[model samples]
Target: MRKNPVFQNEVLGAAILQVRSGRARSRTTLAKALGVSPSTVGMYVDRLIAENFLSESGVRQGPMGRPRRLLTTLAGAGWFAGVEFHALRVQAVGVDFSGRQTTAVVRPLPAEVTADSVIKTILLCVAKLTEAMQGPLLAVGLGVPGLVDPQAGIGLHYAFIPDWNQVPVSSLISTRLGVPVILQNNLRAIALAERWFGMGHDLNDYVILGPRSGFGIAMVLHGKLVEGAHHAAGEVGRWPWPLGGGDGTSQELHHVLSAPATWRRLAGVSVREKLPEDLRAALVEFAATDSAEWQAVCADFARVIGCLQLLTDTEVFILHGPLTALGERFCESIIRAARALAPALATAPLKVVPSVLGDDAGALGAASLAMEAWSPA
Candidate 1:
């Protein structure tokens, strides 16, 4: 006997997304967009409707005589929870099968949030959101600020949080919530969100440079994430920098790119202010100047990105975190520096942009992973 899978999961995923995106509402439109036979589309559509993943919402009266039936995803079929494991706070968001977010809440952890307390906080966040779900909460997606061993169901090393080394995180959550849990590095999680719904969606090769707590990088080459051996591909902090290197000085890439450090280096500027306007103004001042500190920061940025141009050859560079406070002008400077560093290949395909989804990126990425687990065939 021989068995071959129908291989309809990709089709099912595409159909669900097309309906949810309002791009292909009718079976005819879906088949045309997906470039599949009408019968193939009908088979999946009928199966999805029968399984309650889709519904005949109504009919759309087009310019022609006949009214076409419109289809929409059944948002109540299943739900997902996304949790971001921050050093000071844990945020949770609930998203439905139709990719609509239902709720989000952030719980502030106490000073020195420990591994045990982190689990408790996650449970609390999940409990708070699960109470409102109409359908089964299928899975929980977590984004921790550390390395995660997904196979071992453990968080390998939490950066800012204490005593999180080698903690059995997923097992703890699964025992409580009774659902599958997946964990990823926080920045890596955000990169996944960008790939699906943010700036990196259109390009096959791109890099996410989030120079925040630490200068981190995540790449998508040939439309797949470059998670290297030990799943530590984007750990750029360990790489040597600046054609002329440093001894943990201001010239070093990681030190110069640190968000709070750069912010503090701006003399007489403080993010702690009476209004957000004040902080934004300070950020603008940092970008609008040619001060020695600002130039040094840009130089360090150029060195790292220049090396990156040779390493990844990606087209887009996405800037987020504290540096984005300065806006697109700052990003432009970094792009120019990269071009100058590689004069021979001066015409590289490069576009520097900021993150669109902002604060919800981590949780949304986790939710996407959860949806992947429950996707229909």
Candidate 2:
């Protein structure tokens, strides 16, 4: 039978993505991971090598078999710009074809942020990266903070900024930059960062619990990101607190578990503009003390994790954002509370790991999006 060009392009793209993301390193592994025959993978690999999109690093000698050739992306192939912006700041990173970040630029948003200002800042940051890297920019991927229609390339709404509804952000940027632009929810983008380059790279199912200025989650089930019907699947922030409670006055998890809420409860501040040394010390002491308020906070976190795990059967819960500053003890407290809530959770293969990407996760995730969208064809 003959081959479809579109299908061949998809397979080729997947092969490149797997190699760039470290999911597969050889044509054999790539074929196994992609569910394609070795010959099919070889065909695409040869084409990619000819196109300068991939290269053979060396050979891996096994104990009792022919050495397997290692596959890797070529850095000079091209580059992509990834930008993640929120009410507070904008982060941009330049990633080569192999998914390695060449440089990152971060700029704080003014006290009053506008859509135009945000776009201008992003363009400026991309220009800086373009100048610094001196490589051809293939495309741009943007991680926007609120509801977004990724397929439509539109930002539906962002509560943080007024008049940030139904903005043609993707086209605006693409038109100005003269390249293709892809958009995704910021939290979901962070989840992509983990799935592509962080700890969740090897896992098929996991959750990224984001509790920074806001509370939300991004889930990966069966090696695919769950975008949901309305692109708001992990908007757990809007879930009512107290689990099954139906009290009309119950606060949303966003208000109860977010860093701002936690800080307000502990330090009488709603925002984390500058966590003073004394405040940081106090936070550490507070967690160590296990005071009533702190325990309540931990208990709330545990309930969220337990509920999500029960719903999704996720293997790991990667914690990201300001709450991570509380240290591993905080994670321990959540685990302990979850076990107390349900003894089964204690025996379950559940892991709560903190994110290693720090503030660059969203930016890196956006870059992954761009890399995934690019095709060698």
Candidate 3:
């Protein structure tokens, strides 16, 4: 048996993307763009064509040579599914080979946050969306909360669920669905989603801020997602708030900035406001308010953003997850505060905006990851 040449080869995948994105139409140009020899690129291009992932459509007349054949992607070659699941909900989306989403589904998680229940919900969502798919489901990308070892396809730990540690989640899902499955941290998945289809589409450096039940971030620097040596590049939840010069009373940024924190603080202050037990509803209440507590929350959150700007110096900060419900005004406040604190280091402007994909980003990002991780063959 022979292994597939196109499988897991960055150069082969790059060749397909170069042609699909219209960045390179000829083997010569693709070789130049990828910084590889023309013959090397030609080999991959030919293999891609044979695999139905690429097709030569026409020719380009060169100024000093014979006509070069032009290549284009075959959008119907295959499709992918992405799933994002946490303790509360499950979301799934389907996209074609060209990265166009065809269908999506969202469902509340079963009361029990067991691994079995979560995987079952994911399969159901995929099945529901599969009915609307335009091609074969080639792979799946899963966005999971907490620590994930994507290369190993394992869910390392998720504090919210019991017995989620070291679960072979990707393999279990793939075995049930009969397709290759990949895992990504949910927050990181949101960043990838932004890169492919949302706010960070045009920028190479940015951060995805998750201020929902926790305070974490996903950093994309120099056109690549940064997962530290331990795969915890953006796990800032445990970091003490205020970065520096904080009194001994300072708390973890996660507890200070999370929606549950806000609700807990409010509940302690007064009974006039009815705080909802549901986290989503609580977030909505938090978003609609401008009380002293909310203002304090904004100011503290702004300081973190300010510190992030000074440290990372990324072009944009995209707010994802439940915090996005705070709307454009909340982002504007963060932007103003961050700029005031960081000041201008360069001529480029700083941007803090809400995610374009909103709650759907995690799932769609999972799908984008699947698409990015695998090339049609």
Which pairs of residues clash in candidate 1, taking residues 3 or more apart in a chain or in different chains? Answer: none
Q: Report the poorest 10 consecutive residues by lDDT, candidate 3.
A: 1-10
Structural similarity to truth (TM-score) of each candidate: 0.83, 0.91, 0.84
Model 2 C-alpha lDDT per residue in residues 87-156, reported as the tens digit of each score: 9789999988777888999998888889999999999999989977746899899999889999999999
Which segments of candidate 1 are over 4 A away from where they belong?
Answer: 1-41, 57-69, 241-252, 268-285
Candidate 3, superposed: residue stretches over 4 Å from native = 1-9, 25-28, 58-70, 242-250, 260-291, 339-349
Which ten contiguous residues of candidate 1 have the minimum total lDDT?
271-280
Top model number, lDDT? 2
What overall lDDT, based on C-alpha atoms, would model 2 receive against the true structure?
0.85
Question: Model 2: which residue pairs collide?
Answer: none
Q: How far is candidate 1 from the true structure (C-alpha RMSD, Å)?
A: 4.2
User: Residue 170's C-alpha lDDT in candidate 1?
Assistant: 85
C-alpha RMSD values across all candidates: 4.2, 2.7, 3.9
